[model samples]
Target: MHDPIFSKSFTRTQRHRFGAIFLCFIIALAISKPPLHLLSPIGDAVKTQLSINNVGNMLLVDDGGRANIKPIADVNPAEYLQLPSDDAQNKRTSTTISAYSDNGIKMEKKHAIICKNSNYCKIEGDVRIDAKSSTILVATSFANMTKSWCVIEPYPRRGTSRVKKWRVATLEKNDISLPICTQHHTHPSLLFSMGGFTGNYFHDFADILFPLHLTSSQIQKKVQFLATDYKQWWINKFDKILNKLTKHNILDIDRETSQVHCYNELQIGLKFHKELLTLNSSPSMHTFKVLLREAYSLKRERVIRDINVPMPRLMIIDRKRTRVLTNEHQVLRIARKLGFEVVEGVATDLSRFAEAVNSCDVLVGVHGAGLTNMVFLPDNAVVIQVIPFGGVDGFARLDFGNPAKGMNLRYLEYKIRENESSLSRKYSRDHPILRKPELYRNWDQVWSIYLNQQNVSVDLRRFKGILVEALTLLYYK
Candidate 1:
């Protein structure tokens, strides 16, 4: 009953509408689901372009200390897909990657790949990462490839910000579409990387060794001694003791930044004194003293000498830093008059220094790093520490008193009376520097006014009594 042409037109229109609806449904499904390209293996080029989350956004620096960071488009999931956790059926996978440095030095060129997760990627084995100004040594089964290329959690306390300045990359792989990015870098060597001339002799020579001592117990079997190029008088002489304790497994990675496995700790200061006390079979004091004597080839019988013949030598440490003797010439004159040999205490030749200290019966020094050389003295030697002002009583006892007692050495501290300090000349008698000594609770303020800037002239008449006391202990004991 309807016109045939009109019926055909209506049927064609219905078919066109149905086809458009089906196409729209297909588009929606495709949008909701992951792309098929994500399922396929990623290409090598795509891997190289993989975005490194926190560490990846680095400013690529050139040889002349210039950074060149190009603006790349945001990564697409289809082009750069994260591998499934069970991609290889949870099987352990391994790969190698090269780590580049700003100076074109390649550190850990071949790193063993471990695994990756959403938050972090781990690299198996030890690695050293170097930057323009710093070198880091990491020791762990796996390294973090996320925020910071750190193996140890919480990173190193001293160089946390410096560690973040590294630009890391991975060598191309054939089987894997993305290069298994490893977190490692390299530098010229440990010597240049440790530090430059700090101008602080105490920090340069003595305080530097404290961190190495902190790693004694954490080092299970091996120690890769770095910065051997800086080895000089004291380091060369005392390294024999280190060699004996570490059992000669101290491999020298000289002039190159390196990370040795099985060693786990590094810290500054004598904060680990308690831990150091428990390291070896014997007490640390006895063990260290014996090792030192062995290194210098001295006998126990030689330490104890005849009291009447003046066979024992006395050495006085003359400091070149703060809190020094204002009238050192006069002090030296008195020392010589008392038949004590006054040594400069600062030695460029460690062998000569060792010989001088080892031969002496009494070692005397103001409260400074120079006193650290007392380690070279004979077992029963007497140590006279001249304590500076500003409430150093407790600190003096903790720093040297306990250690000397432990090492079987007679320790004597000469506290500086107010009249003896040079501060008395500069500040008014009623000034806070003179009166409110309790304000020394702030270490920096105390250091500025008393320890770092002040000097002293010992009241010779009063100091002679302490000198006599030291001699009595050395002669009688």
Candidate 2:
């Protein structure tokens, strides 16, 4: 017979000890009201997003986001939908049309065409579709939002078709919507964007006479170029760049709108060196010196003006959706405003992003991966973030986690509305079409808040105070 007293005795003592420690911990936690919320689960999620690494068996998909198991139940092999091979429609089902040289050794052109969708008509990619598809590998299908208009990016080279034979696909956009395509025969046709001038802009040469139609081999060549010339920086940043490029290619890419914003070989290499020099020389960097300022009172403020576009003392913008400003353009505006020479940071690869950010006293941009550069910023840097007007992300992480050991982190956010959170949350509640809970929205915003949200408030005055302190410390570094 087991002694109940023994089991109860240890259990009781363990509970009592744990309870006592818990009380003390709670008391200490209350006293601190910690800025980082080290113990809060929300904080943990934040930390997870910002700094946690995925280990073995932990998969990352959707651009460094956590891996997930598909929720749909196992399919009955016999019942699975299958495309017919012998049927006329199925035989003509090749969505892609390829024009090759007589020798068949060369591809003259490969076009993906789409004649119609719900109420829209447009070319999706190099391939065209005459049928309706809810989601597509590339957004070549005509999709209607509140109204009908073609949306394109990276490169824009499509004009709405004048033909009245088709119309834009009806898209029901609202909360709980995962924008999809529909078909309509009567209405204004949306001539959506085209695709594949070059597979991806990263290094494609559609502009050249013998435009280097690209392949994995071509991208590899560019990667090699980066490694060879920018050897020092490239070695350290290759993994980051490779991961970013591959994932970008797989997801979040609308073959219709995706292109390399900049792919010139010369331009790519120069981007890194220019920023490295700038960051090392920037007065904004004095991480080592700023630490000592607390012991003695030192205040530094200098009049600044944007060299190109005048950026307010505090400017918040977004980057994920599209990067409209060039490095030099952006740096010139903000740095000049602060009385520094206009700065330009180039991106031959990923690390250049870090070098560029470290050159500034303050950095501002959207809730996109580029801002992840903040992780590499010199300690004592100030960051201003802008949430997308209608975008959300769950796994998106930024580098502004608890001020790196000796760093002081500050955040300023501006938005189209009062709602503040990661873009994932914004869309989760209102995707235009197929939105669901687990995958509907990244749900990341549930953890993130805008600077003005009741839960988190960051004002300009406080921001400037950090700048002032940062500037004061630069003299020592």
Candidate 3:
């Protein structure tokens, strides 16, 4: 309405005032509104702001909303975090977190969730935890709020009527629940599954019995036994002795089955040999000797009668596989020369074999399965283990010396010299096979080449001293 310059100025002033009001309103709105973290997805919000550089010692937020957490010595800002929401609308299908125990056993939890407010972590879906030996624990739900205790609910078996009567028994009825809950402070019951027969005498027969010797008295009453080979006749015979020793019922389990829950497990090896030797006062040794006597119907008087004789009856184990005595005739000639009644043959009958071994004063054999027959020997008997080349310190001790000590047999090792080994003929002087037996990349190859395929040529001059030692031990004992 006024002059053109004045009108333009008024219009510009009005526009500037409106723009300033709008800018003020936008700034006010932004300042009053809640944070983006409250409105957006939790994982996305956390990923944007959270940085975890020391995941090994701190809680690691996983994509599935589960947190891999360790025990916190002192609470720090970084150690605590808000967990994702549990609203049905915001929930995802699954999540996982990896955890480790103080003993370094690794465990993985799947479909896990953590509550921020309560600090409780829950594991959902099927979870299997393996303890030592063949024992396993299966649970459907597990929760841990603190590092002190973990709560596990056993996975319910289908078609089971009673909650407490879940564990199925073969013959006897027990009202134990599946994944039976025991207090964290109380000692849980132990269950041992018979490791299947490895066929080797030392592995199958003698080694399996070692666990009975290794178990402590505190847990012995709570220990349960399970055997997979219930149908094998030899296993039945072996079970008799095991039952007598353990004084617990041995349950039969299906061959294909796996997974059991126990507080502890027994493994098969000579690692506990020293502990086993302390069981001389245990009834197991006496039961074992009695069972052997009953199995062959041998009179104790007869065994005693044989032991009292002056010359020791020496049975040189004839090998059918590896480490055969190449100079058996000369070796036998030498053995006979040493006043030993040498009994040598591939024993076809086990009873007769047991009887022969039981009657012997000294059992001589190259390190092999035949050496396991030393279990049948009487007390004060001598076991002359021929340490084939590459077997002096390793298999020789594990296979014989340790077990011989447990059986109360005097163990004598006859270490074969380099010249006695047949590998010298097949390999050159500078070859690794001849010089460095340990350098072989595969132990099985070394065993096959140096032990399984090779035979021994006893240097009679050198071996005589070992025989003399055996005689001295037998005579002195």
Tell me, by TM-score, which candidate is best: 1
Provide the global lDDT of candidate 1 against the true structure: 0.44
Better of 1 and 3 by TM-score: 1
- TM-score of each predicted structure versus truth: 0.54, 0.26, 0.53
lDDT of each: 0.44, 0.27, 0.45
Q: What is the per-residue lDDT of model 3 for residues 263-322, given as tens digits with 9 covering 90 to 100?
A: 223211111222123334554544456555665655431223334676567888776446
TM-score of 1: 0.54
Better of 1 and 2 by TM-score: 1
Ranking by TM-score: 1, 3, 2
| Residue 312 error, candidate 1, Å | 2.8
1 versus 2: better lDDT goes to: 1
Clash pairs (backbone) in predicted model 1: 47-178, 129-185, 130-185, 189-255, 189-256
> How many pairs of residues in model 1 come into backbone collision?
5
Cα lDDT of model 2 by residue, 73-96, tens digit: 222212222112112222232123
Q: How would you encode candidate 1's per-residue C-alpha lDDT over 14-92 as one tens digit per residue?
A: 4334433443343233223332112111010111222323122211110111011111222222233322332331243
Question: For model 2, where is the 10-residue window of minimal lDDT?
Answer: 267-276
